[model samples]
Target chain A: MLTTLKQHIEQLVPLTDAEFAQIASFFTEKKFKKHQFLIQEGEAAPYEFFVVKGLVKAYHTDTDGKTHILQFGQEQWWITDYQAFYSGATATLAIDCIEDTHVLCITRANRELLCANQRKMEQFYLKKSSFGYMALQRRILSLLTTNAKERYEQLLLQYPGLINRVPKTLIAAYLGLSRETLSRLS
Target chain B: MLTTLKQHIEQLVPLTDAEFAQIASFFTEKKFKKHQFLIQEGEAAPYEFFVVKGLVKAYHTDTDGKTHILQFGQEQWWITDYQAFYSGATATLAIDCIEDTHVLCITRANRELLCANQRKMEQFYLKKSSFGYMALQRRILSLLTTNAKERYEQLLLQYPGLINRVPKTLIAAYLGLSRETLSRLS
Candidate 1:
């Protein structure tokens, strides 16, 4: 799992062995069973997770008890209630395991210290955050312009294997389509 | 205008006068009339702007000829086709002036050089990127869970003065609400 973390960071910015050791010391690994809650909505998020194996989703439950899928995390993906984690606010999203999972976790303080001490880690994080921003920018455009069918199609094209990895109903929720409409589109 | 830039940067991370001069040297000031294009959709975006005065908006026009506003930029705000600017892709959005505007522009290369040379600027950019990501995360949730009226209300709450600064029709488009529906709600 730690090897995966090293590779993920290296994929963004190559690091020296000594530097990798320094970054590795800041993270702790944890495992969760399928359906386990990693963090709950409306609560403070203490840490961010980097997935090494299995699947997890960040989502929201509305006042009417409808679930809205925000993001999914798989191997090499990072997931967290970023607003809560960064701003010290309560989370507006919850994350739970879609399958038994392993993740490397880092607290806000440790992540900051790592960045301050390791310029390479700061560059890696900066790149990740910028990429994440671009992705969300595209997602907002899709939501604003595309219909449910087009959105479903675009999602398929972007994440070809996601249809197989995620349950159909959850995908429907992610696309903001009713289950019947999603079934028809699928 | 440069004073505003200094204050904006200093708000996030304080710097010496020498540091501010290094940061400011990379930017060039430009002025645009209302209705001028910053960068058109489907073209390369060469620069990102920091608004000094007046107003601007980033928008997407769908194939069906409907316009959807992506973001608004006012005093001290950063505006650009971020996906294109960051990735060297053709813009998926166009940014144009809503009123006569003055802005400080920076090319991608200069931005990279600035971050490479200045640790404080890198820190500033990282903080800005993370904040932008969190804002987008909340936006995605709003799109998924809220109705148009609720979205409009939330927008009003978030940007209290925006309603008065922007034209009503543009606000309607931004909220993905029909002009008639927005009129009724507003």
Candidate 2:
């Protein structure tokens, strides 16, 4: 599990054994069963989770009680109510496991401390954040310019195997399409 | 102009005069007239601009030739085809002046060099990138969950002065609403 994290970090910045050890110290591990919520809306989101195994999703429920999936987290992916985690606000999004899950969790304090203490870790996170921003920008563009069919196709292309893993209804929600529309498109 | 950039940087990380001078050395200043493009689709986006004066917008034209506004950049804002800029790809979005604009620009190489040489600058970028990611995440959620009227109201609340500054058509595009619909909502 630690090796999974070390490799993820190394994808951006090379880490020595000692450096990896120091970086690993900041994170604690946890597990969840299917349908278990890692974050519940209106609660404090104290930690961000990095998935080592299984799947999870972060989503918002609208005033009408419709769910809108924001993102799905697989192995090596990070999931949280990031705004709440960073700003100390109550969570507006809920996260739950799709499969039995294991994740490494880091608190806001420890994340800041790790970045402050390790320049390489700061660079790693900087790269990750930039890539994350770019991905969201693409999603926004897709939402603005594409129809449901186009979006479904684009998602299929981008994530390749994701269609097989994520529930079709959840994918429909993420694309802002009804399940019927998604089924027709697929 | 340098003071503008200094103040922006200092918002995240305080810098000594000497350090500021070194950091400022990497950027070049440029000005553009209204409707002039800083970045054009299909060309390489060589620099990311930090607006010192006036306004700019970045948008993409779909296959049907409809323009979707991705973002508007005002004073103290940064604008670029980020996917192209970061990945060495050709521009997919075009950035053009909405008002006669003055900006400080930095190339990818210079940005990398600055981060490598200055730990403070790297930290500054890390913080900025994280905030940028969070903002995009909120926008994604807004797109997924909100109705046109709700989105219009949210945008107005978040950027009170922006509604008046940007043209209604662009705002409509940004909100994914028809101009008539936006006008009715407003």
Candidate 3:
């Protein structure tokens, strides 16, 4: 688990062993069964999870009784209700496992504490935030200009080779299309 | 000028007088005429600008010779090429003033310096970042689900009374629709 975190951090910015340790200090190893909720709506997001093993999805139901898949987290990916985790608000998103999973969980308080006490940790957080910002920017652009076929292709690119790992219906929801439309395209 | 910054900060987290002064200390005021590029693509983005007066648009031109307007900043709003600013990469986005403008600028180095030296400043950064995160998330969802008309309406709702302040072509680009389509809808 620690090895996984180290690898992920290195991809963003290289850190010494001591610096990596300071970041690892905030994370605790956690296990979840398939179909378990790591987080649920209306509760503060206690921790953001880094997947060590297994698949997970983050989603929320809209007012019209529809479920929208916001993100899917596989190995080396992180997932969280960022608003709830950062602002002490109730989550609008819920996280659930697709398979039995191992994760590294870091709570809001611990994450902030690490940022305060360690310069390298602050740098890591900065990098992570910036990358997230960029992804959001790209996703917004895609949402504006791309068609369903283009979106599906992009999603496949983002999660490469994982299309068969999950249901088509969920993928349809994530693409903001009807299941019939996805079937036709598929 | 300071009053606008104060009001903007207050909308996030209310600052005491001293706290406001500390926040203000990081900013340097500057003026620009219409069509001035605040920062251009392929140049490193060194600072974030807060608009005290006038209008500016941030955009990126893709390989197809099409522009994507990421956002626009007017009074009480902030703008930057966040990816380039945080990562020190050459900017993928560019900014230009639509009219005469005054801005308060803070470089990447000074932002880090301010956060390191002041707890209040760190909190302020955190609050602003969280808001940015939420806005990005909403943009992602909007991209997935909204039609052109619906998306335009949402943008109108977000900017409120600022729609008339900028050009229709840019607004159409921001909405991910052709100008003719936007014109037809309008």
Candidate 4:
């Protein structure tokens, strides 16, 4: 599991074994069963998690009780309520397991410590955050520009395995399409 | 103008006078007239810009010549075709001056060199990128969940100075609302 974290880091920056060991020291491993909640709205979200196995989702529930899917965390993905984690504010989003899950967790302090001590880790995060930012920008473009069929196709292309794994209703929410519209597109 | 960049950086990290000088040396200042293009679709966009004066808009135009506003960068904001800037791909978006604009531009190489030589710059960027990621996440949520009027209100709240400056047609495009619809709400 630690190897997964190490490999994820090494994808952007090669690390010496000692450096990897130091980087590994900041993280703790945790597991959850399918359908378990990892974060809850209005609670503190103190850590960012890197998935080692299984699936989880982050979402926001509206005052009207509608749930909107924000993202899915599968193997090798990172998930967190970033606003709350960084601001030390209550979570506005909740994360729940879609399948029994394992993740490596790091607090903002430990993560910053890793960055301060291991420049490679800081570089890794900068790259990750930049890529994540670009992905969301593309998502915004899609939301503004694309039709339901185009969005469905883009989602499938971006996450080839997601359609088979994520519930159809959730996929509809992510695309901002009605279930009937999504059914027609798919 | 470089002082603006220094002030923006200092908002996140304190810098020695010499450190600020070294950081400032990596950037070149550029000026654009209103309606001038900074980045054009299908062309190399090799610089990330920090706006010191005036406003710019980044957008994508579809096959049928419909424009969708991706962002408005005013004073103290950064704007670029990030996809192309990082990946060395031709830009898929275009950015243009909304008013006569003055900006500080940094190429990725110089940006990385600065980060390598100045750890604080890396810290500044990590914080900035994380904030950008969270802002985009909130945008995706608004696009998914909010009605036109709610989105309009949220946009006003987020960028309090925007409504008076940006053209109504562009604001409507940014909100994915028809001009007639936006007129009704406003």
Candidate 5:
């Protein structure tokens, strides 16, 4: 798991052995069973998780009990209620394990301290945030311009293995299509 | 205009006058007339603009010739075809002046150099990108969970003066509401 993290960070900025050891001290590892909640709505989101194994999803449950999927975290992906994490607000999005999972977790304070001390880590995070913004921009464009069918196709193309990994109903929800509509499209 | 840029940067990260001057040297000021293209589809996006005055919007026109609003840039806001700017791709979105506009423009190469040289500016940009990501997350949620009327009300709350400044048709387009529907809601 630490190797995965080291490789992920090194993709953006190479780290010395001493630097990696120091960085590793800031994060702790945790595991969850499938269907267990990593974060719950209305509770403080104390840490952001970097998935070392398995899958999780962050979603909002509307008043009508409809689940709106905000994002999914698979191996090597980072997941959290970022607004809540950064602002110290209660989580609006709940994250739960889609499969039995292991993740490396870092609190906001530690993450900030790490960045303040390390220019390389700061650069890595800056790049990650920019790419995250770009991905969301693309999602917004797809929502605004594409029909359900086209959205499904776009999602499939963007995350090639996602269709097989995620349930069709959840995929439908993610694309803002009904299960019937998504079935037809598929 | 430089004062505005300086103030904007200072809000996130305080800088000495000498530091500000060095930072300002990397940006060039440009002006545009209303409806003039700041960026056009299929063209290279060479610079990202920080609006010092007036308004601009970025939108994508689909194959069917329908326009989808991505974002609006008012005073003190940043605007660019970010995917193109960062990835060296041709622009998919067109950004145009909604009012006569003035902006400070920075090329990607200069931005990289600035961040490499200035820790304060790098911190400022990281903070800006994180906030940008959070705003997009909210927009995604609004699109997923809210009706057009609800979205319009949320937008009104978020940018109180925007309705008066922008045309009703454009506002309608931005909210994904038909002109008649937006008129009725208003």
Candidate 6:
């Protein structure tokens, strides 16, 4: 289990065995059944999870009780309400497992400890954070300028594997398009 | 001059005098006249600029010849085509000064050196990058779900100072609304 997590960190930066062990100590292994809530709106987000197996979705609910899918996280993906995590404020987003899942969970305290101890660990987190930032930037640019069809095409390009993994309605919600519109386009 | 740069870096992470000097050594100061192009589309983005004075805009021109403003940089803001900066790719975006500007510029090579030397520098950049990403995420969500007027309202709320600093046309482009539509909304 540590090996999987270590490999993911190594992809961002090379870490010595000791360094990896230091990093691994922060995470506690967890499991969730389908539809389990890993996080909830209006609660303080204290932890972020990395998927060892299965899938999860992060989403927000509108005042009207409509759910908007923000992102889907599968194996090797990290899931969190980062806005809340970073701000140390109440979460506006919720995370839930779409399938039975195993994860490595890191609490806020542990994350701080990791950053304090290992230079390489901090660098690894920074690189991972940068990747998330890039993805967010691309998504924003697309939503601003692209039409529904164009948005779908870009989504296809960005997450070719995701189409097979998640349902169309969830994809529609992620794109902020109606299911009928997505059905027509498809 | 160094004091001003030190303050800017400290906004992200508090740096000791020695650490600040080490990071500052990588930057080369330069000046540009108003309306001068810092970067042009189809060229390599050689360096990222740290503005000490005046304003700059980064934009892209579509096939229709209409320019879309991605971001505006005022004093202490970092400016570059991040895609080019990170991947060593040619820039699709162009950057230009709106006013005569003094900037501290860092080459790609020097940037790598800074990251290599200091874990704090890496973490600082990561924090800066994450803020931009968070902004982008909010912008995307707004664009997809909100109308032009609603988006304009959001722009005002999110970047009130920027609204006053830039022209309506640029604001319109940034919001992905036409100039005429923006005028009508106003």
- The DockQ for candidate 3, computed on C-alphas, is 0.41
Residue B167 of model 1, lDDT score: 88
**Top model by DockQ, which number?**
4
Question: What proportion of the real contacts between chains A and B does each prediction keep?
Answer: 0.86, 0.96, 0.37, 1.00, 0.86, 0.51
lDDT of 3 by residue, A64-110 (tens): 77888888899988789887887788998899988898999988888
- Scored against the true structure, residue A24 in model 6 reaches a CA lDDT of 85
- In model 4, pairs of residues that clash are none
lDDT tens per residue, model 5, B111-160: 99999999999999999999999999999999999998889999999877
Candidate 4's residue-wise lDDT over B1-186, tens digit each? 988888899999999999999989999999999999999999999999999999999999998899999999999999999999999999999999989999999999999999999989999999999999999999999999999999999999988998999989999999999999999999
Per-residue lDDT of candidate 4, residues A44-145 (tens digit): 999999999999999999999999999988999999999999999999999999899999999988988888888888899999999999999999999999
lDDT comparing candidate 5 with the true structure: 0.93
True contacts kept of 4: 1.00
Docking outcome class, model 2 = high
Better of 4 and 6 by TM-score: 4
Two-chain DockQ for each candidate model: 0.91, 0.93, 0.41, 0.97, 0.91, 0.58
User: Per-residue lDDT for A1-186 in model 2, tens only?
Assistant: 899999999999999999999999999999999999999999999998999999999999989999999998989998899999999999999999989999999999999999988888898888999999999999999999999888999998876777888889999989999999988988
Each prediction's TM-score against the native?
Answer: 0.98, 0.98, 0.80, 0.99, 0.98, 0.93
For candidate 6, the per-residue lDDT at A161 reads 81
Clashes of 5: 0
* Higher-TM-score candidate of 4 and 5: 4
DockQ of 4: 0.97
CAPRI rating of model 3? acceptable
Measured with C-alpha atoms, the lDDT of residue B1 in candidate 5 is: 83
Best by TM-score: 4
Q: Write the per-residue lDDT of candidate 3 for residues B1-186, one digit (tens) a residue.
A: 889988887876777898788878988999999999999999999999999999999988877788888888888777899879878999988999988999999998998888777656666666576678778887777766667888888988999877888889999988878999999877
Which portions of model 1 show Cα errors greater than 4 Å? Answer: none
lDDT of 5 by residue, A1-186 (tens): 899999999998999999999999999999999999999999999999999999898999899999999888989888899999999999999999988999999999999999998889899999999999999999999988889888989998877787888898888778878899999999
Docking class of 5: high
Pairs of colliding residues, candidate 1: none
How should the candidates be ordered by lDDT, best one leading? 4, 5, 2, 1, 3, 6
iRMS values for every prediction = 0.5, 0.6, 2.3, 0.5, 0.5, 1.9
User: TM-score of A-chain in each prediction?
Assistant: 0.97, 0.98, 0.95, 0.98, 0.98, 0.94
